[model samples]
Target: MMGEDADMRTMLAPPMSTPHDAGRRDLEQRYQRVCDLFPDQRVEIVNGRIVIREVPTLDHNRMIFRLLLQIMAFADQRGWTACNDIKLFLGTQVDRYRPDITVVPAEPRMWDAENVYADQTLLVVEVVSPSSRDDDNLLKPHSCSLAGVPLYLVIDPLEKTARLLSQPGRSGYVQQDAVMLGELLLLPDPWDLKLDTGKFLN
Candidate 1:
């Protein structure tokens, strides 16, 4: 399915509740307060609660930087808009997340200081780590789908595979394509770009 179709499906889907709904408000308030004090930490809210990830390992950092550089290069060449590690607010119930990489069509609003919400994000990429596999593959994609983010990419270094998720239906990605090393995956428009799996694993 195309990105536009996935977006429409996401818009029509109903909301899903997280496990920690009871103290959600309190947790959100505390997280906000902490964020006010430290804007550089890049904290996120997941499953109706706050989650702070530690500094990644050297290998993790290397992979993230490689992906970022590639995306940035693509953006530069194609005149697209790509952001690295930007916080995205995905749900009405205070679920915020920071995708490792996000790609959006070039828009003036993206540069505006007042526009904090990016409802037009075309693609979101997450680099999986031992501590975040569940969240990356399940919770994060579910939330993104509900919020109408068109495409979700999960790069699993452990498995040395990339899962491309499209057709975001009521329960997250309705269509999943697993691309192993030596294969290439093509993204939908406005990207319409091809990614080599070997480059990702290395």
Candidate 2:
């Protein structure tokens, strides 16, 4: 039995590092350097490209703050944390995201280092800006759905609407609900909360 265990351990040991491994590590270090150089902007890897997002406008910040205030109390009651601009690891192929707002379990077990797995998040909210309209409206929903995120909310100031996507699956969200700004948005099961969007119109 001891001999068998030793053999198994040897088999499971990490393989010898290759040139590819060194290259990957060097890329990671370079990415970290870029992030350090631009601490004020959002730097991400998307589709194997390094993208830097400019800081948001005041109106955008205010809108997120309004939504955050509403979600904070509810999340607190449910042992979830509501945060803005946190790193979210989307998938294995060099994709990272910083959702405008994210609701996640407060427990450390749900987190992965400094990044949160999309499948473990309770909700992800994206407030659209001119530069990110396509990504926020189309690409994000698809990625989040594939990652099994339960809920995704899109607030579009340009459209003056809010959309809630639910029932994530291999294909995408099976259900979607939308309302104009200033209307009440219903968050379904597991949330069962009503969001008052009256103040969002400012």
Candidate 3:
């Protein structure tokens, strides 16, 4: 749903705060206002404010596409569902995110809806872009962890590296194992697989 009316481009915004750090209902209302107005736009509540990022660069888009395909292959072998850029409810009224790649249950709970519930999510992957570097590296990991997502993967195409963050807690991930391009990217527990990151390097 690209290129909509000019009025729909206008965003509803509120003063920023950490999600769940302040008025919960107010945050939801603020986001809902945008949702009702710009239903077609890709919007998210980041740091308790509506964050709308521009379309990704070519490198960023290619990396995201490659990773999504790789993850889908991995999930296919294990009979799990892997998807691209799907909206996630995250079980909190304050924030919702559409991860670059999302791994969920075979039958996701919120699959029928436009956005799926965070409960169905087993892993959330974010491919860092120039614009989203900080959030992908910091805020998003914390957000995904707090949402009870067991795994959070950060892929940096510029650096040709990836970080697998697991052992989620309220604060953030407790364990982090990083791998560079040409190195074996290992996923833990449920899907013990070594992912190939060579394509991401280029």
Regions more than 4 Å wrong, model 2: 1-30, 108-111
Candidate 3 local lDDT, 1-202, one digit each (tens): 4545544554454546874556777777777797788766657888777877677678877887777766777788777877776887766553688788888878778834668876567788888877788888988888778777888899987677899999888878899999987778888878787778887876
The number of clashing residue pairs in each candidate reads 0, 0, 0
lDDT tens digits by residue: candidate 1, 46-135: 886677776777877777776666567767786766776666755446477878787766663342342225457777888889988999
Tell me which residue pairs clash in candidate 3. none
Candidate 3 at residue 40, lDDT?
62
RMSD of 1: 10.5
lDDT of each: 0.74, 0.83, 0.78
Candidate 3 residue runs with Cα over 4 Å from true position: 1-26, 36-40
Score every model by TM-score.
Answer: 0.77, 0.83, 0.78
Ranking by lDDT: 2, 3, 1
Better of 1 and 2 by lDDT: 2
Report clash pairs, candidate 1. Answer: none
Q: How do all the candidates rank in terms of TM-score, highest first?
A: 2, 3, 1
* Better-scoring candidate (TM-score), 2 or 3: 2
lDDT of 2 by residue, 20-125 (tens): 6786677667777888999878887654456788788899899999998888888899888887868877765446778888888876333466688888888899
lDDT of 3: 0.78
The TM-score, computed over Cα atoms with residue i paired to residue i, of candidate 2 is: 0.83
